[model samples]
Target: MNKSSVTVQPLRNTQTKIAIIGGGVAGSTIALRFAELGLDTTLIEKGPSLVNGPPICHLHAGGNLYREISDEQCLTLLQQSIETVKVYPQSVNVRPTVIALPKTDHGQPEDLLPRLEKLRKRYSELVSADISNKVLGEPEDYFRFYSRAEVDALVNKSIPSKATQASDWLISFANFTDLNKLKFPVLLVQEYGLSAFRFAAIASLAIERLPSCHLQTHSQVTAITADEDNLGWQVSTKLQGNDNIQQQQFDYVINACGFKSGEIDDMVSAKRQRMVEFKAAYVAHWPQCQGLWPEIVFYGERGTPQGMAQLTPYPDGYFQLHGMTQDITLFDQGLVASSLQSAQPKLAQRFIEKIDKKWPEQLIHNRTLGSIEHMAQFIPQFSSAIVAAKPLFGAQQIPGDDPELRAADVSFHGKHYARAEIVKASSALAAADAILANLSECGLITDPAIEGYLTEHYFPVSQQCSDIEVTERAILLAKQRDYPDALAKNL
Candidate 1:
């Protein structure tokens, strides 16, 4: 429980040691796997442990396991996450809720039905194959289909009328009925608290379960040098509150410093170019009212960038109204308040309205308003303009005489961007999920591996888009998609 002290030590010749920078889920999971494999591991964290540090990204452990990862990996992480929950019950949380497919508010009856059917089939297949326990129940009992009217009734009663709609309909599911079934502990439910809890619990378990591993905090690794004889790495770091710099040599280095991924790539080989930049934003939370909606609403265009808002329930008889805006300037208190007041003036007023409509005697007190500032400070932005068709499976075509098909070296942009590689928003999450799954499946960490593939790739990168173009496109798409619901409603 002690904080890492500021000290400098000279490099010492020692056995191969693994250095893991960043204490988030990816970094900690890798560190634990390395330690379990009998490697001398050191985990460097920029922040304090979960209990004291700010909230980490709230992730549905099961959701990430299911959609973002492979079937094998999903099962493994699910078991590991469950075990972590058992050991640290106070650090984990779960709720019974269904996750439905994205739906359109106004669409052809058949169009929405087929999409819903596809989602249902996929969900059933996943549960049958991946879920450990199986229970027979009606569709609504397990996962129900609600009409637009039904959805409206639920939201009007459960959520404030003024709040922005984040998504359509609700899918509710259950959690581990018995905490005793888990090996780790489960924490209280909060926004994005599960991912943070898992990160902490796994780190704690690794430190306790593996004696050879050491975790260091406030150590910023600035540079790395590879040893010639073994191609190992010599890592140099600047310790907080200390004048002397420290350097240590290790047989291997795992670069898990997210957002600074490009920086780490610079320290090692220069073959890999930094292709992504990250941006951060703020999420605001509003008061919860009785009869509030239970659906996970997503307000925004399908393809363009747009703000999102949702209502997640907490155990303490309170609902959390969560919203995200892309404009960083709107992240400030004054701007946020003004924006909300202007956009949804009735959001605050709806508390009284809801009380009058639903629970009459319930006097709402201690209306606390807070924001998850920098919950996920960075969302990745890829830098590529070219788009190529996905590789065809089982390809065997050779036009040897054609000059365009000649076997020769080709170059672009002074370096290859992996040849027609496409970037997507869900790529990072999918990759992380797969990595965790593999770690669990393999029973330990091995060489560097790439998992997860991008879908719905974008070109020209978000950064290259001129401000006017980005704004115009976003506005057009938002209107077309009825984004944020409120914006669409106003329009």
Candidate 2:
């Protein structure tokens, strides 16, 4: 048949019925895609409806999304992400910002240059690719670069005080620049404000599109039961503020409950051998705080560590300062309050001392107000075949009419402390290259040239325990009915 003459007919009975357990970005996005494709979909959220807000980098930062995918795939993802932001303006936030690394004020130390060279090479390689470079290039068509001296000059002009120590270096910068070369620091200026609610709303929109989608809010799913004679599963839940119990059955179940996946797995009697929960802390402050670097500055005793502090301007004359520390128990209130209490005094004292020794006129104390903390548990995704073998069975019943099951062995905050290694800039770039190489090797794409370019341009630095083989095995076990920990190849 001729292309124009061929009539496209919609499937009469090919609709898919889907149920999403969480309403976060991933779940909501899945829901939307399925719904758009005319599937029956429902999304359940444990918390209140998501508040629409500006897209925070924390929600979609590098380690969260970019690390696993190839450059071409990443670009496509980034574009889709940007488009998603536009579609759900209320549910997403996007700040047109660029990251910069400034020099330490203590001195042009020996170890600093090598780090810069590594960063420079990686930065160049990213821009060298036509697709990736489009995201990095300025309107003037020149690549952006910063020297230690230039960063210092900008700092002096902005702060202009003797109290700031040279050791207090401003190494990284995330600025908003036009297609033209004109650029300004995010803290010094305001660009976009996205509501957190908006992101959640858009996610809801996406989830609603799935076939047979059901979203239960404030309903705690306590158990999962697999059908003995069919390919289906049942979920048991206790409704919030009600004595009544509820149950749901579906052909398939996707547990996107994040760090809480282990508990959900236990409810279904799914055997999960190795699930690790890593804790992260975030802090935000207002603009009145003095001695605050204009650009996002990364601090390392040996010099500046790659990807440390992320300083971004928030709505209502406030700025968010994010640092990923080793502590996992610290969440919203505790994390924010502690960061302000600890950071304010030390930063103020340092800035004041530097001012007393250097330029006196610019000395000021900048204290952050209204601090907030967030704790997230990341669980890796596994194939469906793996999950079917270890179908998370619903909670076990006790003989004495008690419906409670013991909690899972894993505590949200009690997992082993994963060490954070400060990688050299070159090393960070090299890791990205390695990820690209792996993607190429898997035959996921046709391009082999990108891997070679990534190798030549980026250098590898220190490695951290972001992903452990045990975690992957746990994911596989949780997914399947037959492949328990005993079936794991690595184990």
TM-scores for candidates 1 onward, in order: 0.47, 0.46
lDDT of 2 by residue, 458-487 (tens): 111101111233234333432332222321
Q: Which candidate should be chosen as best, given lDDT against the real structure?
A: 1
Sliding window of 10 residues with minimal summed lDDT for model 2: 375-384
**TM-score of decoy 1:** 0.47
RMSD each, Å: 19.7, 19.8
Candidate lDDT scores, in order, read 0.33, 0.32
lDDT of 1 by residue, 1-491 (tens): 22222121211222455676665544655554444434467877655441112223333333221232234333333333333333233333333232322232222223323333443354456456645222212222333444444433443333333324322213121110111211111111111224232334434543544555687777778887767763466788887777677898765555554434434555554333322211221222222223223323233222123333333443322223333443321222211111211211122333224322321222111111211221111100101111111100110111112211211111111211111111211122233333334333433333333122111111111113233333343334334422221111110
lDDT at 324, model 2: 31
